[model samples]
Target: MKKDKEKVLDEVWTEDRVREFLASEPKAGTDADFHALLKAYQSMRADDFELFIGMFLETNRNLNATDKAGRTVLSYAKEHRNSGEHVAALEAKGAL
Candidate 1:
């Protein structure tokens, strides 16, 4: 039972799940979208974040999205600890 619970907790976020959440919004280039991406970046592992970002971009989501304070997802990834991989992924995607 404990192992089952742990497995559930360890369930990975799929591209479909990411799309479903983003699709809830009317548009893609909103501050809300940026914030959501920021939150996901902060919470997800480096590899998972890369996958999420890839899926996000695949759906035509904004890669250069910025928050109200004018912070881009690239900025957030750069500042995050152990996010070197994430930053590199974002850069490859042209996240400036």
Candidate 2:
């Protein structure tokens, strides 16, 4: 079926904008619940992820937590090949 480009974009743009609007929710602090933590993790870019992990690890938290998808923060570092602070955070998190 031929699709109308404008119609598709209009439909998609609302959700996209909403997602973007809702993306950068600020956590109160280190006690982010598991769901919030997962969303925060999923929403992060590589550098942001590293920074967050560093924050957590600085307070002695482990970043190697498995999500509902059975993926860990280590999984993201491995997937992105990010061999920097993110990796360090994961290591600090006890993520092998």
Which structure among the candidates has the greatest lDDT? 1
What are the candidates' C-alpha RMSDs?
4.6, 9.1
Q: Which ranges in model 1 have alpha carbons more than 4 Å from their true place?
A: 1-30
lDDT of 2 by residue, 32-75 (tens): 32333355455554455545554555555445545456666566
TM-score quality measure for candidate 2: 0.38
Candidate 2 deviation (Cα RMSD): 9.1
In candidate 2, residue 25 scores what lDDT? 47
Q: Model 1: clashing residue pairs?
A: none
Report the number of backbone clashes for model 2: 0
Model 2: ten consecutive residues of lowest lDDT: 9-18
- The residue-level lDDT of candidate 2 at 71 comes to 63
Q: Candidate 2: where are CA atoms >4 Å away? A: 1-37, 67-71, 76-94
